[model samples]
Target: MSQWQQPGDRRTRGRVLRWNLAGWILFGLLPQAVAVLDASPARRYWLLGLLVLIALCHTVVVNRPDNPLLRHGTYLHLLALVLGSTAYLMDGGAAFYVVSLPQFWLFTRAPRDAITLSGAAAALTVFGGTLHQGWSPQFLTGNVISTVVACVAGAGLGLWVHHFVVRSNERQEQLTAALALTQKELAAAYQQQGAAQERERLAREIHDTLAQGFASIVVLAEAARAAAVNDPVRCAEQLTSIEQTARENLAEARVLVGSAPESGVAAGSLAITLRRTLDRFAQDTGLTVTAELPDVDLDQRTRVALLRCTQESLANVRKHSGASTVGVVLTELAGGVELEITDDGCGFVVEDSRGYGLDGMRRRLAELDGELSVISSLGDGTRVLASLPTHSQDRA
Candidate 1:
């Protein structure tokens, strides 16, 4: 395949070089040939000299469109044409000689100047030709008319070609710019899609592991509440059970987050993340941390939702509510998951909240088709309740 591609590339390069070379040769060398063919021995030296001068002007020096040197090049080319035409005219009855050869320069060099150069050369050719052919009114008049006709027609044609080339170049530039922009947009779109896929994967992991563990914690916490009066020892057992549920769920979360097990970073799992967050909150503000979790099957999405919601609510409690004890609850409802965070803090009115905590909670819940409820008042405790959607909930 590489060999085939190499040959194809070389062929294309060869074709482009050939086209450029053909254009240069037709414009530069053709005039020399005309001078050689038309001039006799007496005029040949002058004609050949002029042709050589044109070749020299165009050959060794590079022609810059804006530099004064271009004017010199144009002058050299036209002077050569005029001198060559004069040589032809000095011969007998040379009527057809005109600036025809010089006009070819317009296509090869600056197309914009083609009309003026070709017209001037044609006019001079007619002048030289008419004088040489015998300046009788009838012949001179006819030749001048023909020369004018040819010059006008050729100038119009050259201008059309110049406009076409300029437009083609402009269009090619636009298409190249558009293609680059399109590739950039396509790359951005692919990155966005990859991010979305990662988010979905995280959600699925949370639903599979942490959600179930939180549900089990809620059951055990509630059991502890019920058994507290009957048997304090069993209540202690239930607390132990909830603690175990939390630890196991956290381990699962760590795996989902891609943290290596050996280093023990846990990458924000329940074991590492929740404990650190709770410890910091308790240490910073004199509020005690209370957690109740149970063992159960939890979906990856449900676990993520519950954990994030809990983290946000507790942070808000620490920052906004001057609470003594913040309660964290994870429970399984009849057919869905539930998380409740209650802080015995100086709460503000929910309607007048200037914080992003509730708003962000609402947004996150909306994605899971969940519902959020907040109850709080000035000087009263704040309570946050989140109810996850059932499997039947509309995801779209």
Candidate 2:
């Protein structure tokens, strides 16, 4: 959309018009004031009245600077033309008012409008000068030539100025609109970043605390059942440990649901959490899993991004890859970190299918200025690779 014009340009134009009117009062009317002293007493009074009336006409319209009445139509120019021509015929010196005629019509009016009105005024000036000074061939020839030249040149210059102002204002408006749109987009992006960060924080907390706690409970129960008849005392100890784990998990779940600081596996290093995730995946899916993870400290956002990518990749393999084995490898690069998940499975064509799971993983990584790539083919295998920058983390 085109931007709106600024008030500063309008005010600048208004100031120029005011100065033009001031010039007419000081230079234009003073000449007529001097000419009136040379007239007969009876004609002098009428000439003075006409001059005052003409000045009043200019004053009335120019005082209402920036008014749409004069901008959208030619009423103000027509008034100037009539009053100026009448004053010129009454007092030859009052012809100075003729200069304002072209200026008013050309400043904002259309080119054809300024040209037509200026031409009429030029004709009237020559006619009035002839009748006032008495007709002569030399006078008529000189007046016509000079009047047309002055009026045409003045009107042409005024039209050019008007065109320049219109173009400059239009460009300024467009720039202003584009700047506003950019600011809005930036604000929306910041908001989205804030929401995504909150989501990742919660997800990391759940994976570290509740999900890990549940996995331990399942393993303990399985151990307890195996020893129930053979070793009753050992099974009793296992039950007690399960009860304690469940109670701790319940408290962690409460903290997760409420507006409280998260308490979970996040307190330790990321490698510990990944180890637990690897173990749980192997225990649940019965898929032989191997991992080569780095021991490094990462900012909160990067840690969350990496953990989520791992969780999503393994989940996909367990549910869809139909793979018997999976491998997870994480390493640090020159300025960033990379994780790769590979599985021998019944993979599908990347172009044919996509679900929210994959899209969500990409989105989560993107929020951290990271990327996720999945390569797969039918009867082949699937590999998910995620890369995240370590230095510039998004706090929002």
Candidate 3:
């Protein structure tokens, strides 16, 4: 799965850099205009320095959002403004302008510090201009206008910058929320898929174990009834046989519900664990489960499901298959698992009976993307075959 990340991080960084780029572009333009108009080398040199300084501000704002740089950058901008204004005054220019770097107060991380530092900057500029301009009437007039204009622009522009950044921050937050919801939805989908697979496995267990058992019970009861009408002594013997058959079915049902007979096993696949279960099963009923050698890696959950299927098959054979031998064949393939249960017993027509045991097996196989087939006759042996797809197997 792809790892999760904050969606807003990229948007915030890109948007902030773009905004500062526009500011630096305007800063660059104004100095080049000063260098072009009514030029002297001393003033041109001052404008060239302003151009370089503004370019540096772009780099600083683009790379850093910390308070100190914002403070220092703001101070540099104000000092550059004062130098530009002084250059214009010396050339007897009619008007002077500062780019008003205090607009940064609203967008930067440390706005209050930007504001405090900007105020100090404006004070130093006004103080220096007043003392150096020699207290003349023209100096007094320029001082008043400069103070009023700087205060008005800083107050109004600071509020506007704050409002714009707040909007950007809100957009960032929304992006983050959307990403979180997407991740949660993906997690829920995986959980549902796991649940569906587990349900299918349980259904198969019911078919292989419980369905087959019920079928035997039906056959045993029918046999006893038919014999009872002809011979009373034989009827008593059949009843005794049916009792054992019913007891085996009850055991199969218990194991189907996960109450397997406590045969101690450290752990492994369903096939491996079932060998141990079948050993105990053989001890209880004197029926053997035989398998040819094969290798497969089965997860624990699959081991239990397969064991239940084996348990149910063995129970049915012990109760109803009037045979001296029982055989179990397990095969492993490159991409799947297969199990075959065979018996040389009084087989019955599979097509004639829609037993619960068969139905359960069919459902379980469906879950595993597998299939079950039964081949048998009234006189010959019975063969039960089931195959499961590898991809459908749950590793859990």
Candidate 4:
């Protein structure tokens, strides 16, 4: 098969064969058909046999258009030339048979070979035609001119068809390559998106389950130690509560890690949840932590954002800040909510990129169209502020 013969080339190959065959019928067969009818019975039968031979040979070659003629297939072109020359000698109408030699050569040979072979075929055709008619000044001159014109016309047509085919093949290859590249890119993007979603899921799970559970354990252990000398019953209860909280945390962690994360926080009880979170933080840290959050209704996402921001801020204070006092304030506005956490710690310079806790807090608030800001300086303090928009309520 030819290199240009792709899986979808069957239709294209068929069209080329049909067009070339049509040209041969009009230019070669029709003329011979007319002349054969005027010849004697023996001559007519001979001419008809030659016509049938040409058609059969051409049919066999055209049937396998994708099979390159150059691959030990010069026989097809030689047969065409021979049959064409014989028909031309019998009658002038079969000139197209000789004319089609260049078209066949174009497919079978390189440019130089095709040109050389086409010239030879033209010479043979002229000689055959002249000899069949007997040498005469008018006939020889006419044969020479007509044969030259046919050869030149056929070569030009064949070259044009070859160029067009080459260009079409190149374009098809380019389109196929581009489509493959696009598919690869889409697969990569899908993989990246899946990875990002997985990471986010893990972060939220750890923050809600393991980290909160650890904080409670620390507080319970501290309380048990303090009550050890004074109240045996209280210490025992504290240990029991610690054990229960630990089991619950383990179960929650298993659920989160083993399956898809829960859909989202519930809308109601946000204020209560926040207050409980703050109470736990105060008990855990033993620092003078103050809060002023109202009982006004807020969406689940907004509540989660504010709660996370508080958790992250207090965590940073415990880990990094040497502060004794912290203040958390939540204010409900006409169209939004504001949260602020202030600390009188040995503050450091705010770097270009905020610390991990602050960055996470910022990202969480940003998802709800909220803004996060931090103000801090050496030896002074740090204040983290967040604000989120809220739709106005309809008063009954």
Candidate 5:
């Protein structure tokens, strides 16, 4: 019932009670009953009455070990009975004292309690025997010596058992505390990992959508400013393109923040979306753009991934490539789809290039179980290939 007492301690005490009960019946109760048959009527009645009292006390101790008052009281009462039985029966009653020794440890909580009570019980047992036998040599040699030896051995064993239980309880408490701390640390690590992953996702989304849109607006504005005086119509068209790009970027921002139902590219067919992007790029940059886009059935996520990859590839081509023409192709492979964007522009060393755009494309494709590969060398045209397996293809 105490905070330090575990269920295991209760079970151990229960087992001790069972063993003690057997000892009482075998050595205490049954012997007293047999002796009652050969005694005077007064002694017989007295032993019978004592046996009933002992049985009742034993039952209360066994049935309600948690009740401290009842358990301790019964233990004290049993010790008194042992003393009385020793005084009345003398040598015959000494066996009851031996059998009752375990109760001192079993009933009390603290080691001192057990030691104090046991020492008192030993002294009372000796006094009761001396009262009847009056320090006779035969009684001193047999009963007195045996009682002292038994008391000493019982006290030593009780101290060892008490210390062992205390150490076991302490160890259990430490392990429980350690396990709780480990669980808290593991949960904190998971929360940190989730936060980091969410940050990375937001960065990728901003780069693919808003950042690319702003870059396009900058390019259009520059072209519009240069053509304003000489060619008003061209300048107006560039300004209009800039406005459209800005509006689209605003929509993308809404989608990112959960205001929009879906991404801007997610509303239409993948082919139509890619063609529109190509047309805008060709009009804005005055670059020769050729495309072979075909409709492919894809989930919203796959479509978004492909569109981002295409946009990133074209943006790279426009900024880095001196080539005047670009080619875009989307085709269905066996069990998969592949998009290839090639430019007849000045290419750089792929390994030496340190850009987040390329890394972002790779990560986006990887999320859809896809892959991106850039093949290019100096003086050679660059080829950006993105491939994703369709669900049907995956099953096949």
Candidate 6:
């Protein structure tokens, strides 16, 4: 009935009940039944009826050990049976008292109750024998002394077993509590870790798409304002570029917010995608740009990573690199594919740079088991190389 009781404990309790029943049959019922074989018919029948009544009481006690009335009443009834049987059968009934000793412990819940009832049974057993035999030395030595000794030993053994079971149950409850606490903490930790990773992903997505588009919008707005009067044609082109950039930023926003199912990158040749991006960069910055991008098969993940790396690299070149020439190259290697973007701009030390754009690019590539490398120095140019393995390539 206790929560600590497992299936195994139920099985063990069943086994103990079977063994106890076996003990009763072998020592209590069989010996007494055999001893009364030569007795008169009425005495034999009455004794057998009493035995059946005792067995029924035992069954009721065992079935409902938690019921206070049944448990207590059965112990008292069994004690009366022991006394009556001892007096009625005299020497023949002595075995019944001895065999019934264990029932006191079996039927009672507490050690005090078991010890008290067993002591009473022992006393009743000795008194019944003394009443019939007149305190004979043979009866005292054979029955009285043995009953007293058994009562003391059974009480001690029952107390020890009761102590052991209580301690074991307490320990099991403690372990169950600890395991529940651990599982709760583990689930909370997993939720926190998932939330943190999701935050990082959103940050990367904004930086690669929305943030870059906004930056381009600012540049185009400034150019359109400057060429407004003198260069109306150039200003109109800048305005068109601005409108296109705003629409693209809107699309990227929709994707980030879950309204759009697809990414900002269109499904097409990777070379054409890079070329269109380059043409936009040239139009905005008026910088000389040359690129050699061949058609290469790549999975969506690899394609997105490389495109982000190119965009981030070009953004750096425009903002930081005050150079006149930039070149982009996409090549297929024996084991993988690679993208290289170079600028003749005044490059900064790669090791000293700790920009989030660069870190985002590296993370994006790393997700595909790819790598990003930036080569630069104070006076020299910067070269950004992004490489991805061919295993995830889409042949179709």
- Candidate 6 stretches with Cα past 4 Å from truth are 1-8, 50-107, 127-134, 266-272, 332-335, 390-396
Name the candidate, 2 or 5, with the larger TM-score value.
5
lDDT of 6: 0.79
Q: Candidate 3: where are CA atoms >4 Å away?
A: 1-63, 69-87, 90-172, 185-310, 319-339, 343-370, 376-382, 388-396
Give the clashing residue pairs of candidate 6, or none: none
Show where candidate 2 strays beyond 4 Å. 1-8, 65-78, 81-98, 106-108, 137-145, 173-203, 223-396
Q: Rate the local accuracy (lDDT) of all candidates.
A: 0.61, 0.69, 0.59, 0.70, 0.80, 0.79
Q: Which residue pairs clash in candidate 3?
A: 204-364, 207-360, 207-361, 209-312, 211-357, 270-303
Q: Record all residue pairs in model 4 with backbone atoms less than 3 Å apart, i.e. clashing.
A: none
Instruction: Indicate whether candidate 4 or candidate 6 has the larger TM-score.
Output: 6
lDDT by residue (tens digit), candidate 3, 1-396: 000112346666557556746764566346455544576777666656665665566466556655354554563455445544543434221122244443345333454655654565555555556644655778657764665466557757766656666676777779889989988998998899888877765566545655655665565567668878787776676566567656766776676566876222235455555565566555444455576535457654445445555666676677667765777777887787888888888988888966666676666566557788888999897888878766545453
Candidate 1 Cα misplacement greater than 4 A, ranges: 1-42, 60-112, 130-149, 166-195, 225-241, 251-396
The candidates, ranked best first by TM-score, are 6, 5, 4, 2, 1, 3
Best by the TM-score measure: 6
Clashes of each: 21, 0, 6, 0, 0, 0
| Each candidate: RMSD | 12.9, 8.9, 10.1, 6.2, 4.1, 3.9
**Per-candidate TM-score against the hidden true structure:** 0.46, 0.53, 0.45, 0.64, 0.80, 0.81
Residue 138, candidate 2: Cα error in Å is 6.5
Worst 10 residues of 6 by lDDT: 1-10
